[model samples]
Target: MDLPPLVEPAATLTDAELRRYARHLTVPEIGCTGQLRLKNARMLCVGAGGLGSPALLYLAAAGVGTLGIADDDVVDSSNLQRQVIHGEAALGTPKTRSAAARIADLNPLVRVVEHRERLTAATAQEVLAGYDLVLDGTDNFGTRYLVSDACELAGVPHVWGSILRFDGQYSVFWGAHGPTYRDLYPVPPAPGTVPNCAEAGVLGVLPGLLGTAMAVEAVKLITGVGTTMLGRVATYDALSARWWEISLVPTPGRPAVTELGVGQDEDPGCAVPCPSSAEDAPTVTAPQLAELLAARERGQTDFELLDVREPYEARLAAIPGARLVPLAQLESGEALAGLDPHRRTVLHCKVGARSERALRLLRAHGHADVAHLEGGILAWIAQVNPAQRPY
Candidate 1:
């Protein structure tokens, strides 16, 4: 099909912009007219992690007029491997601030807004408004629904993408154009059943492939020069290096409109409030955990500390008297059935993220009294035994 002639005005590229965007303008599909639309477009990227890393970099380079980054995390040393937006020097800094600094250095033409907090029902509409587009690069369902609902209410288009291991999924939802996220993912996966990037793991370069596709969709939306990914979802398998597309249509009962916020739970998929809750929703904190372990040491309790780190990590150092259960094998129904749900139990992994997931999984299978060691075994090493080393 012949594409529409992007009617947007030609942007006045400055000497720096002209130099930076000369390549884009030279393309017949983009040229000067498309460049102008890009210059005037505003976009919000949720999460400054794996996907956000490349999405922000490309948006900055594409000269999107304004970019908003929202994240409530800090830069950890481990994040540098895939969260390319941050560097070694930025360790321990707020993610939004770190991403903003990097965007500024990459392209001064793009104005950057930073929100150093998680997106919630209260703040989702407020933060998502005033932007022409939204990008979903978050690693969990809670934030994804928050962004999709906010964008649907605000009448803004969103490009959604997710990466895990060798696989990734992308979709475009513009309620005005077609189905919203609610129409597509009508229900979240049972809470802890789907492990996030932190637990399941993602290849560092995976985001670059998916995020760049998002940037492409955003550019298409602004310039009106080509087919938008709206109503379509894209999936990529890195190992096979192949791409597939899926079509999404609005559910019959839902109507299309431009509102600023949807009532919570009005949509079936948005019913779950938090990502960690679906599987029995068990949780435990540091102080509570400390007391339990102490009781075990004193022979006051009969519970075991289940360490879920991989054998390699467990071999480096492990909690005294703790049993090892590699995280990958955690999905087996019988892997942890040996534990007595009647007794208080503490589950841990290398970092707390995996253990938290494990705790939820245990809770799913009638293990009602399970508790995850907050911050995982790493926290134990820090607070309980400083001299103990970890892999």
Candidate 2:
């Protein structure tokens, strides 16, 4: 869509700003006028993680003037695989601070604002206000809807990008001008229906491809030199190396988003199932599972160790005696064919989330004695068997 420029040109570019953006000046599409617009734009990026890493770096290098980073997480060793904005030395440091430090080195002229807090109903609106545009790089459905609603209420254009494993998707949403995230996802997916990057690992370079595209969308929106992805969703598959597009339109007579969380059902972040205190919802630690397995082997006890993960994961690594019954079969009741409700059973998956879901399913089916492995196979590998490889 050929939308008007989101930002007006700055009064005058400093000598340093002009020299810094000299290459952009050479482009016929993004000349001095477009460069000035970019300098005056205020862009807020939610979740300084995978998708945020490359977007922030490129936006800073393009001199977006002011970039607001909102994230409550810190850098971990796992994030190093894709979050290029943070280095090895930044481990344990807040992501907002780490990203700001990196941006300072990339473009000292651009101002970086660190929100340093999670975006909840109380804070989303306040954080989104005054920004020319917001880039939604959030991971969970909870924060994704929050950013969309907040941006809609504030009437700021939003560029949303998502990456998972070998696939990626991105689009632009502005309720006032076009379809919104709500239009794309009218209702939140059921908890545990979709897995996160941690549960289903991603290629490290995938985010860089999608994140850079997100940055391009932001720049186009700011400068108004190119058509924006306002009403279209672009998808990429790394394995096939193909790009596809899907058109989107606002639902007819969809109620106005007069309130925050209008499209949100619940805030189940990544569908993580934390330990519960209820009597029926029992959980066992990795060490405890190990001991239980040992005691069962010694004929001291009897229990079924059910691996709720997929078959391919079992091929990679699995507990020695666990039986593979994928979570889907359990959820669909197909696993009931050979089921023994009388037998004590323990369930586990890549992480504890799906196993907990499976446990709940069995509990609903009158399984009197059932528990899920806390922290799942990863924890077991860390505690019971360090030799087992992790995906």
Candidate 3:
């Protein structure tokens, strides 16, 4: 399809902007005109965590005029590795506030607006309306769809990104130029089916790589120079140090521009966890787990409680009837096929980390009834069955 005419370029940057962005203005692809556009552009990044960290830093450094942050999470010790925007002093502080303080320090010229509340359906459109573009750095499905739908309604292009372990995905969605996120993932998957970074684990540098790519996309979109990944989705494999691109086309019969509205039916890809897969895995929680164990003891529920923890940890204490299937061995492939997807399955590790990782992998592989013991067996021991031993 033929592309639409590009917007007129913004006027040249000021002397101060030139010096602040000398490195960027020096680049032929992004000269004074681009710097001016960057200075005038307003961007809202949904999450101030991993993906938001680098994305916000680059946008601020590039002189995005107004930056809006929407996040309710506090900066935790665990987030330091990937969320570069937050520092030791900011730990325990709200993520949005922490990020805003950092942005203020990075460039006083860039105005920073902070939304210390979580982004939800009711407030999404209101918060996103004034922005020129939105960068979705959220880790959960609910917020991803919320941001995508709001962007589609506001007609603001969204730079989307996600990372897991060694892999990352980035895409540009919605504009007078191309398709929205609904075109890709029209629905959200079952809750908890998709494990988060805390559960699945991500390489410390992975989000930085993806977030920088998002920053680059935002710059290109705002400047109208070089290639914009409007309809193309880029995938990165950090372990292999390789990148792949796939083109996305608008779904036939999907609404054009005006008919678009925020509705559950609009996002089909939302039905499944992002990084869509052919696999079908189910996830369970701690309460449900204790109930399951109780039912099994009473011969009411018949299923498998596969202990995906290591052998050394298992020696510490194991749940009755829980079979050990150390996570490392499951990576080998054969050990994984031993379980029955059609039956109820519960996975657990020491503190629920590896079990959650196994849950995502199992979901990717087509198992639908798998769940990790909430807080793992540790919680099981603390709450449900006090008689049960935990390590």
The collision pairs in model 1 are 153-259, 352-376
| lDDT digits (tens) for residues 6-79 of candidate 1 | 23554476787778899998999888778887887778899899888998999898888889998898898778
lDDT of 2 by residue, 1-391 (tens): 8898888998888899889999999999899999999989999999899999999999999999999999998898879999999999999899999999999999999999999998877777888888999998988887787788778789899999999999999999999889999899877676566788877779999999999999999999999878899999999999999999999999898876665642233564322122333355578999999899999999999999999998988998798889999988988888877779999999999878788778888989889899988778989998888987676
Instruction: Please write out the lDDT profile of model 3 over residues 1-391, one tens digit for every residue.
Output: 2322223445766678778889987899777777777777888998999999999998998888889998888887778988999999998789988898898999989999998877666677778877888999988776777777677778788899999999999999984567777788776664445667765679998999999999988888888777778889999999889999899977878755442234443223232234432233334666777678789999997988899876776786677789999888777786877877788778887666577778887767778877777667777777767776443
Distance (Å) between predicted and true CA of 363, model 3? 15
TM-score of each: 0.83, 0.80, 0.72
Leading candidate by lDDT? 2
- Could you tell me the TM-score of candidate 2? 0.80
The alpha-carbon deviation from the true structure for residue 308 of candidate 2, after best TM-score superposition, in angstroms, is 5.0
lDDT of 2 at 173: 97
Model 1 off-target regions past 4 Å? 1-11, 255-284, 312-321, 327-345, 350-391
**Candidate 3, residue 113: how far the Cα is off, in Å:** 0.7
TM-score of 3: 0.72
Q: List the candidate 3 regions with Cα displacement exceeding 4 Å.
A: 1-15, 27-29, 190-194, 256-391
